[model samples]
Target: MRNGKATIHDIAEKLKVTASTVSRALNDNPRISDATKKRVLKAAKDLNYQPNNIAAALRSGRSKLIGVVVPTANRNFFSSVIRGIEEFANSLNYKVVISQSYDDFEKEKQTIEALLNVQVDGIIASLGKTTKNVDHFKKIISKGIPLVLFDRVTNDLDVSQVVIDDYYGAFQATEHLITEGCRRILHFTSAQNINIYKDRKRGYEDALLKHGIGVDPELILFSDMQLEDGRRIMQETLDRKIEFDAVFSSSDYSVMGAMQVLKENGLNIPQDVKLVGFGNEPFTSFTEPTLTTVDQKSIPMGQITAETFFEILNQKDQGSIIPKKTILKPELIIRNSSINKEN
Candidate 1:
């Protein structure tokens, strides 16, 4: 036994029986006599013989493991979600294996294949920006393995999805800017393929519409939610000679990049160009302007995802359960970015 892990051979030797006999006893084969079955089970318990899960999975077509696919571990939001998932999974005696897609569809495909090869009972996933073909996901579903999509889920799939109200959060933030007397507000968004981005963009649009302000397509720009992407976009805005009074970015890192560019231009934050960002990163408050942003309930989201997956897994023995889709509300955190002291 390695690291206190037991092998079937240990139990069979202890009971003076063949390894096959011990296996049959564990599986409750009718061929094994009751007395021998009891003796084998006692021996297994005494020696703490735990069957190899890999072999068991091959026989029963399932390993009590849950697979999770995320973009990356760099962000606090994703890390918190993983923590929540792990905690919930541990409490339920289930193991979790996580994979990083790095926003690459090919990496995602390979990760999913690896999880499936291990015979995971279920999968929890957040789609990458480059994920356009969902045929691989469909194939996983066809294998009778339940799938749960979260965060950046595909709009085309008819599957259960979990995420926050991005549109409302963005709308609220934009509206706050309008209330604060920002006549020219720029919106920095990410990929349009994902539902979260689409929702946030819709919110930005709706806020402008509600305020009776004319929508300027030129004021909106899309980036990859990276520091460099944010820096490039802000530089381009400056090159266009656009004098915007405020900027609302979809990501905190992007907001930071914009701030860096603005600071280098000798432009005072709030006094010159007010800013707001999404995803309440821990470092937001420490920024010079202190970013105003949206607080996505990440820990709860992760916990709920785990709970929902296990709820489905528990019901699998009975039959299919009614599909569940849960959407949580995001709260806006007002900071120096959107709120000028003079106002």
Candidate 2:
């Protein structure tokens, strides 16, 4: 019986009981006697029976599954977000289905389709760098599925969104440098598809303008959010013989790149060129002079995102509630890198 396919009827036949009784025992119905349940279990064990997940999902009204799509799960920023999502989702008795798009728009679309095919109850996502099409997301909305966008969100989509105040954070970082007496500040940034980079750029530029400093286009370097991009941009700065007093980078990794070169050239931080980086990553503190960066309250952002998604799930009058764009203020962490010590 274990070698061949085993069925409820097979167990019933062996036990001289009706199929209904066998089913009840297997289901552990309260009405079934303990002795009968034990017998049915033993029989099932002997037959090596297994329940089908697909069949079970079909029987239940909900798949009890939530899909999570991120640009890359490997990134420290996104991994923290995923941790927050998983923690909240688990407490609500829902399972998570995760997929990575590697910042590819087409791959993101394909992953969403697959999630839909599996009938996920909801979706929580951070848009990829290359994701320009909002139609895929719109379709999810049209299907009446709840979607919570965290971190990277599209402006076109009218949905629940959780984000940090990038502009303010950027403003604060740049302002700190200006107050420290660093003029001719340089700004390093990446693509403007996402609001974070754009806001930081704005903050940096605005701070300079407010301080009566003329904005220099040559000082603004566009770079990819990669270690090599940082190294390459620093090299370009050297090749151009661009004299600058300070540097503000939108990414911590890029700041690290700039610092490596600056240190090699024996230019002291803060004394020669004040430095500030966004995204207060872990390595920021351990660096030689430590790093002055912006802390976006990443953990809280994740928790709020999870809470928002759950609220949408439980609210009976979800349509009546205004679509929310929750923005949290960013905190500027001033460290040794950006502050000068008078001898």
Q: Per-residue lDDT for 315 in model 2? A: 77
Model 2: ten consecutive residues of lowest lDDT? 52-61
Which parts of model 1 have CA positions greater than 4 angstroms off?
1-7, 10-51, 317-320
lDDT score, candidate 1, position 13: 70
Give candidate 2 misplaced runs (Cα > 4 Å): 1-54, 317-321
Candidates in order have lDDT scores of: 0.87, 0.86
Clashes of each: 0, 0
Q: What is the TM-score of each candidate against the true structure?
A: 0.87, 0.87
Q: For model 1, where is the 10-residue window of minimal lDDT?
A: 315-324
